[model samples]
Target: ELTNRSFEDPPGSSVTPSGWYDCGFEGETPPDILPSPTLNIGKTAYHRSTYLGLTVRDNNTWESISQELRQPMQKGACYQLEVYLARAHSYWGISRITGKEANYKEPALLRIFGGFDGCDGRQLLAETPTVSHTDWRRYVLQLEPALKPYDHLILEAHYGDGPMPGPNNGNVLVDSLSNLIPVDCNANPGLNKNPEPEFAKRQMLSPKEADRDLPLPVSEAAKGEPISETQLLELITTTAPRIAFDPAGNLEHSHYTDPLTNKGKWANLLLKNILDGLAQHPLAILVIVIPEKDPNLAALKKQNLKEALVDLGALQEQVILRDWLEKDVEKVWYGNAESGVLMRLIR
Candidate 1:
C-alpha cells in the first residue's frame, strides 16, 4: 500500500501528508483534511476521523494531490485502484483570485492519470463520471499497462462539463484510497483483454437495430378500434375526478392551520377547485395523489386537505388519498413544472 494512504498523519489546514505532494496551481490551496463529523453538510466520511477535501473554482481551475509510486508499474499487469468519493453539497470560502465570498454547490469528478514524468505527464489512464451525490460511494478503475511503465499517479478533483447550470465553484471529498493491487487477471476473463471471441460476437447488435427488433410499443399494443358512443359515455361516467396542487406550495407547511392569510387563501382556492370538480361528477370518485416519500406525512397532508375540503362542503367518504412515489410519477408525467400533488381522473 502507498505510504500515508489514509492521509491521517501530519494533519493541519492546507496540509498534504507525507509521501504525497500537492501539485496544484501555485498560491492556490492544496487538498486539506476534512474535520470529523462534517457538521451542517449532512454527510459523513467513508472512513472515520479525517478525509481529504479538494476544491475547484469558478474559472475552471482545480486542485490535485499526487504521489510517485514506490515501485514502477509492471507492464501487462492488471491492477485495480479504488477510492471513495462524495460531493460537498455546500461550501463557503473566499476565492483567492477574486477575494469574494464563494458559496456554491457543484459536482466534482475524480480523474486518475499515470505517466512517466514525475506527475505532469499528459497520458490519460482512467476517469470517473462526475461524483455529484452527497452520500459516499466507491469508484474503481482497472489499470493494465499495455506497453510503457508508469512511475507516478495523480488524483485530480474538478468540475465536469455538464450543461446543467449550477454554481461554478464546488468541493469534493476523497477518502479511504486503496493502493493499486494486482489481481489474477486470468481468473476474471471480463477484466482481462483475452475474453472469448464468441462472447463478444454475441453482443454485437447495434442499438438502433436492436430497438427495431423489439415488439410493438406499449401505446400501440393498447390501441384498439374506436369505441361506440354508448361505450364512450359509460367510460366517461365511470372516470373519477382529479385536481393537482404544487408540493412546494403552502400546503407543505408543518402546521395544520395557515399562519399567513395569503397561505389560507391559496389553500381555499385549491379546495374550491376540488369541490367544483366533485360537484360536476357527483357519482365519480375523488382521488388525490400527493408526491411524497413518507406515507405517514402524506397521510397527514391528506387529512389536513380533507379538513379544508370539508369546510367547503365536501363529504369525507367521497375522497380517497394516495401517495405516489416521485420517481414513478416522473416516468408518466414529463412536465418540467415543479413537483406537486397530481389528482387525476381514474376508473
Candidate 2:
C-alpha cells in the first residue's frame, strides 16, 4: 500500500504531506498543501482532511512528487491504479515570466513515471487526460512498463496535447491514491472511463425546469410555505434582467441602467427584489446557476454575481451557486454564454 495514500495533512497546512518528496523544478517553490485559511480557494479533500495541489507554471516549470514504491514494478506486468484528481477554480501564484500575480486555473494532466531513484521520470508509465472538473473524480490508469523493472514512482503535471497556448498556468489536485494491483498483461484495459457521480442533491433547488432527468432531493425545507417557488421566482425576476457572462467570464449588461431607476440594474432592482422576498419569507434561498464549462471561468462568473449580491446587502449564506451541466457537449463552443446562469428562489 502507498504511504499516506490519502495525502493527509493537518487541516489548513501548506506543508508537503508526509511520505512524498517534492519533485518540483529547481529554484521554484514546492507544491502546496491546500485549503489553508490564507490559500482559501475552497478545495475540500477527496478522501480526508487535506489534499495535494500541483501546478504547471507559465514559465514551463511544473510541480511533481515522488516516492519509493514498496515493490518493484516488474517489466511486462500490467498494473491497474486508481487516483482522485480535480482542478481548483482559483490557484493563485506569481508568474516568474512576467513578474505579476497569476491564477493557475487552467486544466492539466497527471503523468506517472517509474525510475530507479529520486525524481526519476525516465520511464513514462501512464498519464490521465487533462483534469478539468472542479469536483473530485477518480481516474484509473493501466501501466505496463516495457523496459526493465523500476522501484520508484513519480507523479508530474504536464501540458498534454491541448490546444491552449504553450507554457500556460494550470493546476491539478491529487489525493486518495490506490495501490498498484497486478493484472493480466494480455487483458485489455480498454478505454478510460470516468464515472460521474449522480447529479447533485441540490437539483430540486435549481431554477431549471424540474422535469429534466436528474436525481431528486430526499427531503424538503422545514420552514412554512410562506411563498411558493413560482411566486419567489416571479418576485426576483420581475424587474431583474437576465444576466449573462462574456467570453472572458466578465458580467455583461448586469449593471445596465434601468430606464426608470437610472442606476446599476442589479444594484437597484435585483437587490431590492431579493431583499423584499426575504422580508416576506425569511426561509427563502437564492440559487445562482453556473455553467459546467471551463471550471475556472465558471467560478469567475459565480464569484462575480455572488459579490454583487453580497455587496448589495444580501446575506452571503442566503445565496447559493449550482452548476449547470450542458448535456450536449457539441454546443459548448457555440452556446450562448448569457444563458449560462439562471437565478431562482427556492426553500
Candidate 3:
C-alpha cells in the first residue's frame, strides 16, 4: 500500500542504487572479513527474511539499501511509504560449501533506508526496525514535524554497530523500498527529468516538416521552394501554347508566366513528362501482348476483349473506362510486347 518507490531504479533490479558510488554491502557477513566495495550486477536491495529462508540469490549480495533522493521534496505533500522488508535474510550460509569459512551465519536487520540525499556515498536515511521470528511483517512511516520526515531510505543493517551479527557486514533481506508523495511546493516548477522524448521528435521530423505545406525557399531554407498551391493548380488546368522536354525531367515553355502563375502547370507537367520519356529514345511506346494463336490463348484473348465490362464487385457490373484497362488499350491494332509492328504504335 505504500506509494513511495525507488526512483531511477526499475523494480527488482540491481541497478536501483545508480547515480552514487562507494558504499558498504552488509553489516556483518559471516566466516571471513573482506570488503572491496562497488560490486558489479547484483547491486540492488530487496526484501528477505530467515523465516522465508534464503531468497534464491541471497548469495550475500542481497544486502538491503536505497537510493539518494533528488532534492528537498515539497513541504506539504501527501506521502505514503511501502517497504517490502523481510526482517531476516539468508542469501548465503557459512555451512555447506564454505570457500574460506568455518561457521555459517546470517542476521535480520532493524530498519532499511529510503528517500535520502547527500551522495558522498556514505549517507544514511531511515533506520530499519528490528524484527524477530519466522513470520513476515509490514510497517509504515508518517511524515511528521516532530520526527521530521526523512528524504531518503535505506534497508541495510541499522546505522549503529550491533553485536548480534546484525552489523555492517551481516545479511539484510528487503523486498522493495519505495515512497510516493505528492509534493506541494509553494513554487511549483516543472521537472526536467529525461527530456529526450521532446528532442527526439523534433530531430526525427525536422527535414520533412520544413517543406510541408510550405512554399520552398521562402524563408530560411536555401533550396528553391515549391510553387504556391494556387499557382500550381492554375498551371495544371492551363493548356500550353507549346511544350518541350529536356534530358532532365523539366519543362521548357515558350509562354512566359508572371508571378503566381499556374494557368497550365499540370498540362505542362504531363507534356514535360512525355517529352522527358521521348528524349531517352526516338519514340517511347507501350505494347501489351494478347495471344490469338492457340485455343486457350484465343479464349484468354476473348476474355480480354470483354475487358470494357469488368467485374465491379457486387455480383458483377460493367467496368468504367478508368476502372478497366481494355477500353483504353484497344491496341490501335491488336498485339502485345512481342509484335514489332505493335511496338511502333503510338497514342
The number of the candidate with the highest lDDT is: 2
Number of backbone collisions per candidate = 1, 0, 59
The candidate, 2 or 3, that scores higher on TM-score is 2
Q: Candidate 2: misplaced stretches above 4 Å? A: 11-14, 160-163, 191-347
User: Which tens-of-lDDT digit does each residue in 130-150 have in candidate 2?
Assistant: 788877766767788789898
A best-first ranking of the candidates according to their lDDT comes to 2, 1, 3
Q: How close is candidate 2 to the true structure, as a TM-score?
A: 0.56
Sequence-dependent TM-score of model 1: 0.50
lDDT of 3 by residue, 272-316 (tens): 322223223333232323323344434433343233122111112
Please give the lDDT score for candidate 2.
0.64
Give the Cα lDDT of each candidate. 0.55, 0.64, 0.29
lDDT per residue as tens, model 1, 1-347: 47666566533456676778887887777776765332234343444346777778776678887788989777777787667677777666676558898664677777777776655845555677777777665565666766678888888876765443333677777876767878765644553332211110112233543442222122111133344433433332322111222221213111123333434222334344344445545465555565555565466456555655655567656666655655655443311122335454433
Most accurate candidate by TM-score: 2
As for lDDT, the candidate ahead, 1 or 2, is: 2
Worst 10 residues of 3 by lDDT: 193-202
- The per-prediction CA RMSD against the true structure, in angstroms, equals 16.6, 14.1, 29.7
